[model samples]
Target chain A: MKVKFLCIIALSAILFACNTPVTESEKNGSEQSRKSESEDSTHVPLATEKKVELKREGIFMFYVGAFEAKKMDTKKNPMLENKINIALDSISGDVIYGHSVVAGNIRPFQGTFNLKDGMYTVVAKEPGDNKYDGVFTFTLSPDNGTLNGVWTSNDKKLAVSERSYDLKKTEFKYDPSLELDGTYSEVYNSYNAKTEQHEQITDDAGKLNASQVELTSKDVENMYRRDLEIMRNAIYARHGYSFKNREMRYFFDTQVAWYIPVSTDVTAELTDLEKKNIELIKRYEKHAESYYDVYGR
Target chain B: MMLGLSTLKNKRKYSLLVLLSVYTYFLWLMIRITLQYFPAHDDVAFLSIKQDYVGMWHYKLAFFIHVFSAIFVLLAGYTQFSESLRKKNPKMHRRLGWFYVIVTLFFAGPSGLIIGIYANGGTSSQIAFCLLAFLWMLFTLMAVIQAMRRQMSSHRAWMIRSFALALSAITLRAWKYILVALFHPKPMDVYQIVAWLGWTLNLVVAEIIIIKKIRS
Candidate 1:
């Protein structure tokens, strides 16, 4: 009986936890950060530039030399060359590849180059179309190998204009990494991943806890009975049963009267009908007493 | 001569079974047609009939219960009448019988009750369908209890009534089709009349069979 009660509590807790609102601190902090970032001009500069060298080899492949840009722009001046490589190969039917240019109609060039220790700007522009331009600002190391500081752009047309990161030898750490909170948009996109992870964790925990609780077969049977009762109440609501006291009494009686016990143990103990009847009796007595105690006739 | 007479009786019985089987098959086809073709909601036939009765959840619950119960009833009725099947597969027959009873009790009976109370065309139709669902559940429950008690004859009689109620789902549609075809009455009027007549005729036929079987 205790184990059955615990199981009910556990199940209810899990459900409540899933539906609980995100903590106020988390929401407030994130909102404040967003507001501060939007207000801070230095965090994201208006424009920057960098030099990029391009080398063309195969039909679609090009070896892009190291280049720098103030801010990486994905839209007008796409720095990702793989996209350009793919688009070129698709159009020309050759396995051509390049470093900075992304495959497709919209291609942006991007690369990394050493610069003297100082604040610098990097820019990418289409040959003749001034419409597409990307720039970024960063401070170079005295050794001419390290590019440290913030990358920002003024162009709103670019998909990705600004990012803050520290770059050393071969490592990069980008700050203000995006995380999906449990909002509608995030939930829709992350549903499959979140649900799968939840299920795996819950199943494992449930198994271990079941053993710790030492729930007898009878306890599990009672838990199922309770689940059925809840299901029947939902059904009753669906059937438009008035929420009056008498109707509720009848609904409770009917549900409790029909609940059958499920046996998970190997021992063949009670016959099906006996088990069913016992469950019904137990449910009836429990629910009836509680209802009267709470509602008073 | 006796052997020939018995053989003839068997042949007649088999022919009746065949006819019932065909009728059931056609009934299922009609139900399938209605589900597939009928608009999800009708302004005239559904909404204008009654104010208290119209809602999305009501319609959805009604449709789901109607379809689900009809399928179970079809399975149960088919097994009940199949002689070769019953003879060769008694276990399957028993299992299907229990399934039919439980499903009718839990899903069909309650949903039907709710739908019946809100039935359009007036009080008479409401009473008719309410009684139909109540009797359907009552007979099935009795059959189950009796079977549990090992009262085979009583169980059989109750089962026959329960199945007759199940068959009303099919007959109701058939009656609707015929009414629309012949008189072309407004859909609401036809529904009201068919709701009562369908179950009434089903019970009447079942009573006759029960009387004859008892006498024999």
Candidate 2:
């Protein structure tokens, strides 16, 4: 009995240690598939019958679920349900994707569209600056983009499964009878989670409370950096692009960066508004050094 | 008695009582999460695990099976260690022991093994949990087999080890809190270290109880 128990223990240990799931990529050799998808194959927009200028920017909201069609009761299941916020550009038809402002706190997406033969295929990928990873493709309806598409990524390692989700989009701003009574502003606390730094919160008398922790110069510097990042992202979002500190890509550029993945369905061109936003961002960057110096960071 | 410690049994009972209370409290927490938090459909604060199980019915069912059976076994499994209860009420002891072993092997151990693979902090953490699951099942099996063959001393020792490992679910969280309060280690580092530390520490204590104390 003792020997039998010992042998069982040995077998069980071997079973567990040996069968710990390694990534399928290692087994299937993803190097080859990666090679095929590795190329920066930029798809140019094929000119169709005629161009139509969009006059109204619509606040688009999308509901996403993972590969479930009919019975999508997420409250009783182990699937991801995401609420995505985006807006379509009034002039260029480009989509501006915003962070979730809630859980998952997804990063900004710069999306472009291709309207060819009355079939609209839109592709959006997260900018390098964003902490999230994924590429999405949407098949847009003709009248306005009522979105239905698939969001896919193979990078996630959970269950060695890809995060291939289906999305449904509704244009929130296009409702004719919509009205707002009051301007709403969400007041944020002095301590920012993103930067792990605290800023001074002054009372009505403009006095910092005694209870507030004094910020070091380094804290001030970090806050400034986060502010700069938000402003920089705003600039990139204007042109339907994301900015990276190390190697950023602008839409107006003639060539694409090697790191930008191959997006087959997207087509975009630089707009006048993008050019203006770029100019403003550039001016701020040029003078921002002095501003930081004034803050003692 | 073997180690000339007259108070050994009392000491063991006291320590076991403390651990038993702690274990009961943690199980209550799990039950609270299932009944109150999950049903209310609350927003995920730090982790999205609630979302994961809530969004899929099969996963939710599996989670409940693992949780309910594991906690039930922990509650019932400890009573077999009482010397007075075993001597006086042998039938109740045998019945409860059978129920604990059968439910654990059939429901708790398998379900735990399934979920242990999906443990967070990446592959190393997953491996740690998987080994834990394996050992949990192995020790329980050894205990049952030893009982069947009338090796009472060996059976009790194995049971102690099995319950020690099973108590890891409680100790894992305890170690994480202790580590964070003391050192404030990185989240991933804390998770990985605590995952290993909980079961290893329990097993060490179990060995001490068995070798120096439980010989009869």
Predicted structure with the largest lDDT when compared to the true one: 2
With candidate 2 superimposed using the best TM-score fit, by how many Å does residue A168's alpha carbon deviate from the native?
43
Instruction: In angstroms, give how far residue A243 of model 2 lies from its true place.
Output: 22
Count of backbone collisions in candidate 1: 27
When only the first chain is scored, the TM-scores of the models are 0.21, 0.29
Poorest 10 consecutive residues by lDDT, candidate 2 chain A = A29-38
Error of 2 at A117 (Å): 58
TM-score of chain B of each: 0.80, 0.80
| Candidate 2 per-residue C-alpha lDDT over A78-171 given as tens digits, one digit per residue, 9 for 90 to 100 | 2332223333332233553332211213344457777776656778775544323455676755455455665544344322122333334432
* Residue-wise C-alpha lDDT for candidate 1, range B1-216, written one tens digit per residue: 999999999998688657655655554453443343244544222232232344567755775565456555655654565556667768877887878877889888878887788775568788988999899999999999998999977887898888888878777877877775566454346667888888889888988988888898
- DockQ score for model 2: 0.01
**Candidate with best TM-score:** 2
* Residue ranges of candidate 1 with Cα displaced over 4 Å: A1-297, B2-10, B13-17, B34-59, B82-84
- On residues B26-64, what C-alpha lDDT tens digit does candidate 2 reach at each position? 655443333322333333221132343445665555566
